[model samples]
Target chain A: MTEKNCREEIIFAGFGGQGVILLGKLMATAAMKAGYEVTYIPSYGAEVRGGTANCSVIIDNEPIASPLVTEPDTLIVMNQASFDKFVPKIKPRGLLVMNTSLIETPPDRDDIEVMGVAADEIAHQLKSPRSANMIALGVYLKKRGLLTPQQVAESLPYVLAKRHHDMLDVNTRALMHGG
Target chain B: MSEKILITGNEALAEAAIRAGLEAYFGYPITPQNEITEYMARRMPEEGRVFVQSESELAAINMVFGGAATGKRVMTSSSSPGISLMQEGISYLSGAELPAVVVNIMRGGPGLGNIAPSQSDYFQATRGGGHGDYRTIVLAPSTVQEMADLMFPAFDLADLYRIVVMVLGDGVLGQMMEPVLLEKKQTHRKLPAKDWALTGCAGRSQNIVKSLDLVVPRLEKRNLMLQEKYRRIEENEVMCEGHLLEDAEIVLVAYGIASRVVRTVVSRARKEQIKAGWIRPVTLWPFPSRQIAAAAERARLFLTVELSYGQMFDDVRIAVAGKAPVHFTGRAGGAIPTVEAVLDEVKKLMQPGKVAVER
Candidate 1:
């Protein structure tokens, strides 16, 4: 409704092939479908390995800039490496989400809002370890008040393409659980 | 043209390609550049255009090669290291004189560089990233609007020269957003059809499209033809934007995102009563030498700003052709220069008696 509907910067960082980039993209695509401008940029180079693969996604009611989020409003660190690499860069009063199973260090800083979700354990409980990224997304959405479960659910088809019809229910359920 | 809409540089380039009548896209995910591929992946199918999320950057460029061979509008994109992987395919495309567009949203380099805005690829892009005595028509867009506007001209240049066209930019340009007017779509331009296209030979002689001209003499002749084409491009396609150059004593030469920062510095300098201007080269190749030389004839000094260790400084020197003093100022590995930093250099350049920092 304003010049900038919701200018939110999010960083997704995890191990290689943890679907961190995919999850970031899902959020960006959903925000874009909600008539927002979105930019998604994935990690490049050796950082894609055990170091830490990260992607930056910006969703704004207005145009975005510099997808490399120097100071993200939301920081989702799925692994220890990511937490170590990105936690200090989170903006004051920004939202920080972590996979409790992987990240041992809690948010030591007082300026940021931190949420720890046993995303891996939840996914395992849901009988899909790969859906941890989705669980993390769900928590992020709930905590930030950026989108609803339905908007995220509506975005699954766009993100997953032809495979969506099969995994749609699971992902939506995951979002519902966290949302 | 449509009403102006704010979009990121990658989205602007994608829209420009669509306006240029791009028929096919094949790209792999890479940092500081995935949005271009993502945009094509989702939009192409809806437009009845072909889009492939190729297994790797290598595969994507080869797919571009296949599409270009058919005289179809085709494009591929990647970042620095991924573009490194695409070099073999690009060399083949260049050798075969195929028309295609390549977008490089560069990050830091020299081996899996971190995913931040960096211009370390200036040498790679300008020196022909691939092997062989070939070149790509490299157009560097400084803003989101130019990202949209330049692609059409790039595609046209590639088609006219029958060579690969590259949009050389970095994460700053790729990820930054600004207002851009989407150009109206027109029918694909009329050009000589490719007889060597692999579309089949039902009732005609077989046509072979190969860069492998094994015969030395034949290869020599082909290389000479390409050399002549590159010369023609240099002569005809030189483009650069000069700002506040009238009666300016000092000139800042820059391109892409760096140029935007310099533009700000120039405006601020004017307010400070300093006669400083800027030369923003839109085409990295065809180096805009004539424009720089023309500016050098009257300007007191030239300052080259970039995101690398002064790669464009070499070109600036060549453009100045030793007539005016040229100085280099830059930062590398995702480091962005501020207007204040550029202004500092401009102030020193105007002094004419300060120690020139050489790296």
Candidate 2:
């Protein structure tokens, strides 16, 4: 991480109510804490409710340019709509992490690596379905080996609102469960 | 304060303004900039400051005008359509010589443009956007970090000059989240006392802050004084950044979010052995003409990239002054100019006789 000027472009996408934004924010905060230059750009246009929600997170060793990412190096999709829309935009030989419980259709590309995590199922076992995004986030971080699940777990208190801190225990458990 | 925090550009600028001793915050709802007002609404009251979500953009600017006269730091923010509504008030702020901050997190324009980021406000911001012999100082921030970094000075420059200072950013710069050290400025301009401020006369003569002057001769003298201030600002307040410019043949010129992409273009072009550089105007009012003019002496060609169709391009052309060919590549209506588009333009201009500077 210190030697190479690595730039990873990841897009996390799901339905609006899926908390995909908080998922990206956790990754961004953890990456920032680990001393990487990062940017998290969320696209919430006029129709923010019940629409397809997406955020682009770029973590790099060097200062990032063009916060907008046209083609992502990694794609994390929670629902089938996101998978259908963003699966084509992933760079060749890139990685795809999708929530397998909801997405029945497999990816069309063979060049990219795909991993399906039962994020919703894992999160439901902990009685916190809302933390499904966290579980999916943990899977990506665990596979990447660059940042740890603990890094994101620790960032929860800082990122989540004070009123929502009660869910910390369940969210952390889901993150570790996915790992 | 030196520790970095991941924050959105809109919140960062609002926080920066709050840390800059902003006494009053006034705003109305608009996208790409809602975060600034939202953050201020949440935090300003907690910090024991004044925060007003005014009735409208007009009301917000009038609130700024009223707050500015009291010799305290005040600010208002809006997007393109809302900002257009506040132009008459902005002109009044300029005419009254009020030291206040205005943030325009611009979006696509000409009518109710989309909420997606656009630099179409370049002309509106730089040209003062209102009828009068006045121009507000405009600072264009290229990144979220710059959004914070420029806020401190935006207020400082406003107070130092007794003029309206606009923090001009597009929706991308406003909405994007990045790591930034939102720190307070330690030093400031050794400003003269606010004797002209309408702080209510106690031991001295009453100070009146207004744009109204019925007497023709007095109005002319006041206008002349304002023009003199503008001249001083041009001489002393012009700020710009040059990148890889030494001995470069092709100059890339942009401001705000457009410059962020153009920077990527220039750096990528460098890898391909293109002698490209960038002239980014941090202060757009004092349009960095001197810097662009200097680049023209050595560069064979110049390209002005923007979100609008050559708003800043006109300024770059004027600055180049026929010393070199100035070309433009841009998009309008919420469309952002990408890195590839700009590189293609650069390569096209690099060819022999695509166009040449007019003698």
Candidate 3:
């Protein structure tokens, strides 16, 4: 029973079709596989019908207090809408990773470190557009350096549905590319 | 099946019921808890058990009443409004002395409240919301794992007392996902057989299973017996988690999702050397009154935080009995009380000669 001290709050935001919830689940799954206490919560309401979809993932060495993330330590945005929505909520000196392929502009924040990646472009090259979420996740894993890309890739079989098993290779490749 | 998996609280709780040897599950679709019904629908049939998506909450709970009469593990889950609809059936279950697990994944209330997490039903749940001279065992889980973990004990306790055990949670607990180790399927406590069940009276005089005793004195006796059973449960099954209570002057009292937030507030208060501690009621009914009264002997003040408009405040006040001042801070209608807001209340009370205890 180690004292719960280290906690990282993250928000993954994107449009409804952008695999935002899956990305949060992947991070949460990887963290759980690494034996850290984790909680993943999607924005639950009418917003999930089609508009903006987002989720909060918290990884901590100890039990999490509140699963909701008010101020995220890391904000990963896949599109322009999410980028504009979640950028202001990042903690000072936090990490912001944006999908440059869809997000035409970067966050105008001086307090946080920003990483712009052509995540959708890379996924398109990999012939798996859905793996773009994996690309942004990989960037966070590589930059945040909390959990490795290999860890998240290894968790793919567990997080993804069985029908999507065919995309594991592309998702893995996308992760490595972002890393 | 034994390995830990990252899953939502509702999903984990549903699987846990399967692991707990659930014989039947009845539910209607409601936000924040529809996952349980969906999961149970697929898994229950797969497990060769009974699952029903009843036409409504009223139908679901009556289904539970029917299922529980024959002496098998039965359950139904719903959100706030749906649970309200099930109240009559729940009261019937209590009067009939049938063991049934009813889960209330609460949401903002008053009426048709939005699908956001809320503890507004604290009063409804702990008070045995339905009717009649009765109280149900209410278990409040603050984490996803706790949601799963408590399901086993919930069934065991329900049968042990022949009462309805309510697993009370809010939208937050139902929607969030966490890593949970699937246990209880491999471990089970041997419980007493349901001899009073309506399985059959084939070999003897037909055993009547009914809550209605038309005779006034017979009904009075049954009510008194139920009260005795409730007393015994209160004596034996009061479950609470006490943190930093020893030598603490300020005590925070909460349960369910609110308790999770209070934990952080307690930690923050402790870091500031305010001697703050917390009491989280795992069993909301069997209200942990004795434990609270024990803490009231030394604590300078008690602050009850809740998601409702201080429904639990009355309980805390009763337990404290004015030995220490009891105050309340809460929000309603999907507004979650943050750690900072609760910590602010703690600091206000810690000020010298500034404690104005709200009666």
* Candidate 1 lDDT tens digits, B1-359: 55455466889899789878899999999878888988998889989999999998888999999999887889998999998899999899999888999999989867986888888898888888878998888999877777888888878887888889889989877875555678854435676656667778899988777899779999999999999999998988888889788888889889887887787788888888899888989888979998898998889888899988899999999888888878888888878776678888787666757655433
| Per-residue C-alpha lDDT of model 3 across residues A65-139, encoded as one tens digit per residue | 767688999999988988888899999999999999988876788999999989888888888878889888888
Query: Which regions of candidate 1 deviate over 4 angstroms?
Result: A1-179, B185-190, B355-359
Better of 1 and 3 by lDDT: 3
Give TM-scores for every candidate, taking all chains together and pairing residue i with residue i: 0.69, 0.96, 0.96
Model 1 lDDT per residue over A29-148, tens place: 677667776666665544645566888887888644234467899899899988988999899989999999888878789999989999989998998777888888888878777788
Q: Specify the poorest-scoring 10-residue window by lDDT in model 3 chain B.
A: B182-191
DockQ in order:
0.08, 0.71, 0.71
Clashing pairs in 1: none
lDDT digits (tens) for residues B1-359 of candidate 2: 57888889999998889988899999999997999999999999999999999999999999999999988899999999999999999999999999999999888888887899888888888888999999999999888888988888888889889999999998888888898887786546786687888776889987888899999999999999999999999999899999999979998888888887888999888898889999889999988899999988899888888898888888988888988878888898988877888888787777665566431
Alpha-carbon deviation at B229 in model 2, angstroms:
1.2
Residue B26, model 1, lDDT: 96
The better-scoring model by DockQ among 1 and 3 is 3
Error of 2 at B188 (Å): 2.8
Error of 2 at B53 (Å): 1.5
Please give, for residues A27-114, the per-residue lDDT of candidate 2 as tens digits.
8999899989999988856646578999999999998877778889999999998899999999999999999989998998999999
Reference-based TM-score, model 3: 0.96
Highest lDDT: which candidate?
Answer: 3
